[model samples]
Every structure is written in structure tokens, then in C-alpha cells.
Target: MSEATGWPFWVMVVAFIAIGMGTSCMYLGAVATCAKNYGKGKHKGIMLAVPIAAFGLSGMWQSQLGTYVLYERKVDGSRGDVDVFRYFLFLGILLFVIGVIGTFALRIVDDEEEEYIDRTVEDLERSGLLEESEFFRPRHEIQAAYGTFNADAEEGSVTLSEEERQQRKRDLEREEEERRKKNWLLNYETRIFLQDPTMWWLAAGFFLVTGPGESFINNLGTVIPTLTPRSYAAAAPPAGLPSTHVTTIALTSTIARLLTGTLSDFFAPVETHLFPPIPEDRRRARLEAEQANRPTLSRMVFLLPSALILSCGYLLLSTPLPLIDPPLLHLTTALVGFGYGGAFSLTPIIISVVWGTENFATNWGIVAMMPALGAALWGVIYSTAYQRAVNSGSGFADGQCHGWSCYGLWAVTSTISVWIAVGVWLAAWRGWKKRGIVV
Candidate 1:
């Protein structure tokens, strides 16, 4: 397709559409699968983070390949044009092999396996060996304290009659049925999730925060040239400068994802009551007591710093210092990359924690769509600014404007957008707090 000059624009559009669809499906499927398999464990955050961090790191290697291996060399020893045909062929074969391997390797834990694991956990909890473990809550204590089990019975010696055992079995079956129902499309839980104001606020925050980062990435090549000295404006950008920034962003983004995922696991509050059998009046008190004792942080706390870091990047780009020495632009990308990567990684974990892994794909899909809108909005703003600068009679060469004026407006606009996102996230945080949701 890269070498087919006869192909129509519509054909190219269809090819792009196909690529986009496949990429989205594969990315979301991998994330949802990880969440389903590991979401109940203590390391759920890091488990989810691994695939997300991999997604960020992918850009680094791919860009490096395109720069160092897939490009033509000029007589002067500088890199020339890219070999788009070979690059496309390489990507196609690489993705095909990965897909083939994934088909055999990506198996979810089966129902029997999950049940056995649950039983083992219950046995350990009952044995009192896990009493000191923060991740496990003793089932026997919960049953006795909630009056589901006989309080008079001895701790490790409680027995159930045949009728009581049958009733307990029926209760478990009913709970399982309800859980399946909640996972169904357009169910009660889905309706509640859609109707919740907090969900929209969270989505809006993601849109505002991620859109600027997306735009910055898409425009990086163009923006870098703008920061070049007028004498060098007509010359090719410092060889590999843009690629270096791309790698920097990718690396920092990957690191941010890993760090945030691990930190969230360590600090975020754990849900104590998976299936609360108590009366509604007493449940709030129980939750309060559990939370007070645990004193875990909310996942929402991570978003504030992420947004601020992103805003700082935008603010830096809007300044004149980067034009004086364009290499200094690395700091901007690093900040934006860290903030962007952390926010993106945290979104899925938050959804899995608050809504649950069962409906995670649908919930995350809804939220994920917001970034495209944000990217388009910022992209347009950025293009308009660049075009205006190009036509400003500023002695810019090759239709490219030099200095801060070229990108300053878009950067300022993005900074404002990120701050607005911070406010939106705070609103979502308050909403979750009001409803006693940990995330």
C-alpha cells in the first residue's frame, strides 16, 4: 500500500480505518483481559499497567527503527527520506507474528481455576495465617460479625447442618446470577453507570488532559522546526532531534505508567465488602469503620499531579527559551510524556476498581473516546496558530515559522485546557467521595 501510487484516496482512507479498528480492538481486548484475570488480586494495578506501559514504549522502538534503519542515507552522511514501503512491510509482519503468538498465549483463567483459587484464599483466611496480610480479610470474622454464621460457635470449629449448607449454596448461586446479570449489556448497572454524573466528569477530565498531549505528539516534528534558529530554518532539523524527543516521551511515559500502577496498588483503598449482606442502614457505618482503620489513599489523588505536570510542559513550550536552544525542548516532551502516560495508565485501573472488571471494556471505551475529540479540538487550534504564524511575514523559510510565536498560542490554550481538566477531575473526585466510592 505504501508504494501503490495508483491507489485512490478512498482506498487509503479504508486502509487507515481498518488499521484504527484493529488497533483499538487489540489494545482494549488485552487490557480488559488483564483486568478480568488480575483485578481481584493485590497487584491488579501493576498487572494492568504492564500492557499500558508496553503500549507507550512501542512508539520509542518503532520511531527508532524508522529513523535509524528504515531511512535513506544522504551523500553528506545525514539521514534522508524514509523507506515507507519497507517500514510498512516490517510493521505488517511484526504485528502478524505477535497476533499469532497472542492467540495461543492470551488465555484467561478458567472458572474452575478461579474457584479453586478463591477456595484456597478462603482456607488461608480461615486458618488465621493471613491475619497480618493487608490484602486479605478473614471470611470467618466477616460471617460471624455479620451474623451469617453462629456467633456462639468456636472460631475454627464452626459446622453447618445439611439444610444450612444447602441455603448457603443457594445464596452463592444467587449472588453469581446477580453478578452475571450486572455484566449483561444494557443492564441495571450499565444504566446506573451511564446516568452517574461522576462518570461524565471523569471522561471530560480525560478528554481535556489527554487531548493536548496527543496534539503535541502529532505536531512535534513541525513544532521542533519552529524552534530552530532562522539561519537553520531551511536546513533539516538537527539529525534525530525529533526522534530523540519521541523516544524521551515514550520512555518517560512508560516509566510513569509503571510507577503510577505500582503506587496505586500500594496506596489506593481496597474494597473490604465484595458482597455486603448487611442492612443498608448499617453498611455505611461498616464501610466508614473499615476505611478509618485502613487509611488508604484514593486513586483520584494521582490525577492532580499528572495534570499539573502536563500543564507545566505546555507552559514551558509557550515560552521563548526553547527557541534559544531547541535541544532544551526535551524537558517539555518529558513532562508531557510522564503526565500523559500516568493519566492514561490510571484511567483503566480506576475503572476496574470503581466499576469493576466485568463491565470495564464498555466503561473504558466510553471514556477513551473523549481523547479523540480533545485531540481534534487541540489539533485544529494548533494548525490555525501555525498557519497564522506562517502568513505573518516573519521571514520564515519553507513555510515554517521560527520562534515561540509559532506555537505559543496553542501551548497557552493547552495549558488552560489542562487546568480546566484539573477542576473537572476535582469535581469527579468530590462526587466519588460523596458517594463513598474509593476511586
Candidate 2:
């Protein structure tokens, strides 16, 4: 639709909206499915990371394709113009083919099969027929059931008294009710999730930190030209430079996603406290069992460093340094890419870990929407600064803003925003730690 030469403005607007909606739906579906399927495994973090990394990687290759194949070459062998019609058509066809393939290729394991495997493993472990190295139960489940086998063995047999049996039954009933509430729309669980102060802190922090990233990525093409020297004012900017930076960002983002995901799995602190509070004796046993394995680092630890790195990137961009003298713009993009990708990947993992994966889709959706507001806020600020520079006659004859005046204010504003986000995230991390809450 965008390729149509005579389409009304409203038609283009509608097409863009439809495309955005479809892309969002696909992203959410893919991530949620991975979270649901592999969220209980030992390598759940890495499992979840794969899809997110792929999301970043797709941008890198696609941008490269558009730059090399979709752009028209001039008679002098220089890149002349983008063939938007061909580019759009290629994307549409490629996406459609991939979507069709994914529809047939993607499969979630059946609950019954999962349950059977877990049950079989537990039975084997109980019979002392399974090696410790062969154990495959989720860490939490293993911790929860840690002392049961030993206790049964010590007693030769075990039996629950009538009162104890009644209590157990009540506990199971309550748990079932809670699960049902979580699944229901506008229920108690929804209210609790929304009312949680921690959730809002996370949302606010995400908004401040990620919004700048979104704005930067969207305006990168425009920003690059502003950094060009006056000597090149009469000439077109290097065609490959913007694409090179984009590819760099995308590549670094993918790596950051994978790195954070894998490291968090090995190092994130274990939460010994289970909700619905188990009996004190059992809880004590669980804690004792977990003490030997607890990691000192929290998953939240990753967020602070990411925010700081992103802030540094913004600060670098805000500087009046010439683009080529130091060739540091690539460094700026790398830091921003790493920070943005790490935070994006870690947020979902934190949600699943802290809130449980049973309602992850809803929780993630609410938190994820915050970046849109941030992006809009920063986008407006960036555009305003650029226009101000242009109006002040600090721009070229063609009305393009040049040098630091074009983007310095916007970068500084984003730097402050990201630093504030760092503070917010720090506060949340401290509060959670003080309360013995796992992030």
C-alpha cells in the first residue's frame, strides 16, 4: 500500500498502523510462546533469549539487504536512491513466506507429555535409579520437593493425620482458586498485579531508559547527516555509513541479549521464599537446601550497568567532537545497542522470575507498552531541537541542521532521562532486596 504512488495520506497512515499492529502481534506471540514452553527449564533464560536475539538479528540482515539490494546504484557506481516500491514488495513477500513457514514449524509440547516426563523422572529419582547428573527437574520444583524422599525413607512409610490431611486439601483448594483467578479477566489477581508498587517502578524505569533507544534508532539516519563536515555539504552523505551503524547496533544488541540471558541463568539469586507460604518446617528445610546454591548476584544487577552504558552513549553524542576525528560514533552506538538489548531481554526474564510465568503475557504487555510513551516523548524533543536549530540559521541552505546544535540538546535530555531511570531501578532493586523479594 505504501508503494502506491497515488494513495491518499490517510491510506498510507492506515497501512502503517496495520503493519505496526501485525508486527506487534507477531512479536508478542513468539515471545509468549517461548516463555510458556521453556520457562521452567534450567536454561530457561537462554531459551527465552533465543527468540529475542533473533528479533534483533533480523533487523541487521534486513537493513543490509535493503542497503545493498533495494537501493538503486547510479551510473558512476555510487548508491543513488532507495527503490521504496521494490523494498516494500520484497519485505511483504518475505514476511508472508516466513510467517507461513513458522505457522507449520512452531509447536509447543503438550502438557500431558511434560507431566508424564516429570513424573517419570521423579519416580526414578525416588528409587535411586537416576543419577544426580541426569536430573532434569526445574530448580524450584527440586527445591520444593528436596527433603520428601529422605523423610519417607527415614520413616519407612508416612501417613497424614486427619487434621493435616484437611489442611493439605484446603491448601490445594486455595491454590487452585488463585490459579483460576489469575486466568480470569479483571479478577483479584489482575487487581493485585496492577496495584503492586514494584510493577509501576519497573514500568517507569523502562519508560525512561528504553524511550531514548527507540528515538535514537528511529532518527539515526537523520542524525548521521548532521555529523557530516561542511566540506561535504555539497555532496551526498556516504550511502553505506548509516547502514553500517545500523548493522553494528543490531549485531551488538543480539549479542547483549544472549549474554545477559545466559549469565543471568547462572548467576541470578535464587528465591528461597515461596508464595502461599509453606509450613514453617518445610520452608526451613527448603531454605537450608537452597543455601548451598544461592548466588550473590541479583538479575536486577544487570539493569543498572545497562542504564549507565546507555547514558554514556547519550553523553558521547551530546559532545561537540567531530565525527571522524575520533571515529567514536560506532562506540556510542555499541554502548547504546548493548544497553538497550540487555534491558529489553532482562525485563521479560525478571517478569517471569518475579511474577511467575502463569500470567507473564499480561504482565509483560503492560510493562512493554511504557516504551511507546517514552519514545513519543523523546521523538518530540529531538524533532523540536532539530527544527529550532534549522530556524536559527544554524542549518545548511537546504534546511538540514548541521553539527551539535541539531541533536546535542536532545542527547543531553535523553542522558538525564536514562540516569533518572538508573536511580528508579536502583531504588526498586534495593527495596526488593530489603524485602527478600527475588528479581
By lDDT, the best candidate is 1
After superposing all C-alphas onto the true structure, candidate 1 shows an RMSD in angstroms of 11.0
Q: Compared with the true structure, what per-residue lDDT tens digits does model 1 show for residues 1-78?
A: 377558689988997788777777778878878987898788998999999999889999998999889998799988
- The parts of candidate 2 lying over 4 Å away from their true place are 1-5, 75-78, 104-107, 112-182, 233-240, 272-287, 322-326
List the global CA lDDT of all models: 0.77, 0.75
Residue 161 of candidate 2: its Cα lDDT? Answer: 63
10 residues in a row with least lDDT, candidate 2: 271-280
Candidate 1, lDDT over the whole model: 0.77
Q: Each model's TM-score, in the order given?
A: 0.79, 0.79
lDDT by residue (26-47, candidate 2, tens digit) is 6777787787788766677888
